[model samples]
Target: VELILIDESLHLQNGIEAILTMVEENPEILDDYHFVENIRQSIIDAVELELNYLKTKFGGTTIFGVSYGELERYMKYIADRRLIELGFNPQFGIDQNPLKFLQKEDVKKLTNFFEVTPTEYTNF
Candidate 1:
């Protein structure tokens, strides 16, 4: 498998924000749903802990100390797509992908584990 390490703080925050936004937009969905209430509360508690840990350890940097240039842009792109899938407006307006720096040949090499076609990989 191709290993891809992501910044947990950023990813988690994106997820939390999406969930919170969904709840805000559809408050009625939680009115009689104890299961949804429990899940939402658990997410809030976990997100609070994660935010505190990230702030304590990373300070102002969301990616910790990793310096994968343009990776942040790619992440924002993906986050925006996720937000769209969640019925929320995209937060970032980035169009170009930083991972586009990877050549088609290199992407082909990763296809064995990535399970994406060369064209799909390049577009991604």
Candidate 2:
């Protein structure tokens, strides 16, 4: 089964704006690879290209382990969770997603809920 993973850091609006700014200023050679090889941010900046992923290319998809692909990125945000065992700082973008609270075995059970498929929906 094939799976698709979405990286919201670059997939979100904030990351798009950064790329547009670079192209607007250098209208000449985005053709070359050096134009936007660097970026920095405290929280989320969409792609946060500073991070590395050999599997993921310009088109899309990133790996987050075998079962992780089942979880949605923003299904549960920090929203100010008040637990210390999770150890996720409030400032961190993920801020203790439910996955963090789950033990390894518990996470494995998640596979029962998701499987890869060629298409999700035909039309609305």
Candidate 3:
């Protein structure tokens, strides 16, 4: 039940490429693979690193709750500002507003969702 809230500005390609290079050089994996497989593996590794960083280092997942005015601030903080800026107010749906339900009780529910709920696949 882990949550991931990307600020929309995070640089993904560079991190993905870096991780792919590392994984490709490792001698323990299969000796041969296709370009698409490499790219897919790179994306998976990059996502895992990002999630682990948010969880272990920050002690929680990110929840982008910026107000309308503060949206620009987060947009600038991300690596691909141009792309993120183009997608301003990127609401997936009316019900997907995290800030709208940021009441204390709602926050407690969200936080507890991570603690009490078991993910479909738990490493432990």
Best by TM-score: 1
Question: Where is model 3 poorest over a 10-residue stretch in terms of lDDT?
Answer: 1-10
lDDT per residue as tens, model 3, 3-84? 2232121234345555557656874443445643554444346445654554554343334643433332232233132223
lDDT of 3: 0.38
- Mind giving the per-residue lDDT tens digits that candidate 1 earns over 19-85? 6787788887656568465654454455456545545665555453443334445555555555555
Q: Which segments of candidate 1 are over 4 A away from where they belong?
A: 1-67, 101-124
- The collision pairs in model 3 are 9-78, 9-79
Tell me how candidate 1 scores on lDDT: 0.51
RMSD of each: 9.9, 16.5, 15.6
In order, what lDDT does every prediction score? 0.51, 0.35, 0.38
Better of 1 and 3 by TM-score: 1
Candidate 1 residue pairs in backbone clash? none
Ranking by lDDT: 1, 3, 2
Query: On lDDT, who's better, 1 or 3?
Result: 1
For model 2, what is the C-alpha lDDT against the true structure? 0.35
Candidate 1: worst 10 consecutive residues by lDDT?
1-10
Q: Which residue pairs in model 2 clash with each other? A: 9-46, 9-47, 10-46, 10-47
Q: Estimate each model's TM-score.
A: 0.33, 0.23, 0.26
Cα displacement (Å) at residue 26, model 2: 1.7
